[model samples]
Target chain A: MDTALSIGSAICLLLGSFLCLTGGIGILRFPDFYTRMHAVSVSETSAAGMILIGLMLQSPDGIVVIKLVMILLMVLFISPASSHALAQSAMRHGLKPWLSTTVPAIKNKHNETASDITSDKGVPPSNL
Target chain B: MIHTLYLSLTLAAFWLLNSGHYSPLILSLGAISIAFVVYLAHKMDVVDHEAQPVHLTLKLPGYYFWLTQQIILANISVVKHIWLGNKTITPTMTTVKSSQKTDMGKVIYANSITLTPGTIAVDLIGDQIIVHSLLSENIEALKAGEMDRRVRQLEH
Candidate 1:
């Protein structure tokens, strides 16, 4: 049982570290502020969650486990609130999201496929 | 009255968990601080249902479990797109109509949208949230309203 628990904790930690690394790469590679924020959000949510959960699993003390859970809850609640605030403020300041020129074509293709599916199902197309 | 009681309980629990030293002096200090803070909170008029959200305590765990699953899936997709590079990404912006009647519900919905990677809630005005997504399909998924429904369920 101890061995299994240790293995699970290790796996979670490793996965969390890997996700953090990818999120860092994403922050540097992605264009514009909003996409970069997405990268940060990715790291903030799952990576932190995984790491905290791993710690909780490894900790033998009840108080330590509760502390870790509290920290996890705080992160889960705060990260998104901060992200929303950042995005909202940035938007208010008129920072346009970078869009690819090819987006229209892909959007049209998606609409066509969606309409086709709806028509086949005998349902009217909802504004998508 | 119930909100104040819950707030004090939460604060007391938080203090106890953090301070392992069971000395009388430290315990008294913690008690005093907690009381002062709670008193200030009451004066500020923030100790209402919205602030405490005692009603959500029963339902939050299930919502959180579902949200965590969605977050994991979104992480995988966003990470895949990151490795796949720019040409594969289709950044799109769209407005999703939220059916949530309460401000708390709307906040939860917007936060859930932002919590999932590859999608960000850029702006929320009334019931319409302007979302920027890394992929158009993410926006499509938001439009499908599963998260909205879940958040609305939390409200009740």
Candidate 2:
């Protein structure tokens, strides 16, 4: 039972860590600030949740479980509020969203032509 | 009065769970702190249904479970799109109408949208929520009003 619990907890933690990595890559790769913030919510929700549940599973007793749960509750409640405020403020500040149409050059199939078009246009936002 | 009792018990339990140190001095200190906070809340006249939300205590767990499942599914979809890279990440904004009557209900609905991966509520202007989604499909889902309906159910 102990070994099973340990393995389960370990798997949860590893999955949590992988989710965090995905969120990190997403933040770097996603276009524009709003989408990046969307990526961040992934980190805040699923990644944070996975880690907290793993910890809760490892916690010894009732009080420890309660403490972990309370922390998770706090994160779940606070994260979205903070992220909403962040996106609202960014929108309020007149930042234009990088929508699909804002990026014009991704559909180009020819690699050399895409690179050539990108040269004077000062780099496409990211790769094709 | 009921809110006060519920709040105090919750506070005490939270303190006990958090403190993890149950000596006389620490316990008394924790009690004193809880008393002071509750007193402050009472003085501020904010300990009513909106503040305590004891009614929501039961409704929330069900909503949370559903939201968690959605979060996982959305997370997998988000990870897939991330690996697919930017072209497929068609970021779009849409405004969805919230039929929730109360402020708390609306806030919960908006937060649920923001909490889910691939979507974030950018602004809550009156009854309309301005949402930015990573995919066009997510926008359509938001337009479908499933989450909005769930939150309204919680409100009832």
Candidate 3:
């Protein structure tokens, strides 16, 4: 039984590590902020959960289980909220979704800098 | 009324559990630390009606477990896509309305959406949320109303 439990824990750890690896890759390969954020969620929630579960299984003690559960709860509550806040802040600042062809732009915080907010007004470059 | 006690007790328990050995010295130190922190919090006027709703806290575990499952599935999908080098990626932006009534509920709803792989909540336009998805399916999933429903349940 102990051996089986150890094997189970190892398997869980491997799976969790793999998921985390993929999440990192997705964050890099995906085209936009939103997609990257999605990748981060996968890494933060699933991989962490699996690892925690694996640890819990190895321990088999009530207190250990409770601690693991608490950690999981903390992660679940914080990770998503942080991601949402970041995304919302980005959008509020008028970050545009990337376009395949045009590389959609957003108006720079100042007109003088490279404009990120794409507008077709053909406004002349301001010296400011 | 109960939240402060709960938080303090939790803190003390956590301290003891983490400190590894149970002894009178450690126990006294832990008690002092917890009391000091709680007292400071009280003096700062940080504990009051705005405290997180304890009733809603019960569903926290469920939300976490569900979210973990989704994350795993999402990781597998994303990894497969990368390995295949498939150009199957479909990026799109969409909007959805949140069903949550309270400020905390809305925050949770938005956070949950961002937590899922392939979907990110970009903006809050009043009750409506602007989200970007890596695939049309992700957007459809949001439309399916699961996230909104789960967040609503937490509010109760």
Candidate with best DockQ? 2
How many residue pairs clash in all the candidates, one count each? 0, 0, 7
Query: Each candidate's interface RMSD, rounded to one decimal?
Result: 4.2, 5.5, 4.6
lDDT of 2 by residue, B1-156 (tens): 999999999899888878888899999999999999999999999999988898899888898889889988998999888888887777766567899999999988888898898899888777877778888889788888888899999997
Task: Tell me, per candidate, how large a share of the native contacts it keeps.
Answer: 0.60, 0.76, 0.45
Report model 1's chain A TM-score.
0.79
lDDT of each: 0.83, 0.82, 0.71
lDDT of 3 by residue, B1-156 (tens): 687887787788778766766889978888899999899988888765456366766788898779667765766775676555425665656567788898878877877777776677776756777777766677678889987888888887
lDDT of 2 at B45: 97
Superior candidate under TM-score, 2 versus 3: 2
lDDT of each residue in A43-116, candidate 3, tens digit only = 88778988998898799577788788889878977886788788777766765555332123333333321233
Best by TM-score: 1
True-contact fraction for model 3? Answer: 0.45
TM-score versus the correct structure, for each prediction: 0.89, 0.87, 0.78
- In candidate 3, the residue pairs with backbone N, CA or C atoms under 3 Å apart (3 or more residues apart, or in different chains) clash, namely A105-A116, A105-A117, A105-A118, A106-A116, A106-A117, A107-A116, A107-A117
What is the descending lDDT order? 1, 2, 3
Sequence-dependent TM-score of model 3:
0.78
lDDT of 1 by residue, A1-128 (tens): 99898999999999999999989999988877877888898899988988888888899889898889989989988998889888888877766666555445322232322222222221222321
B117, model 1: CA deviation in Å? Answer: 1.0
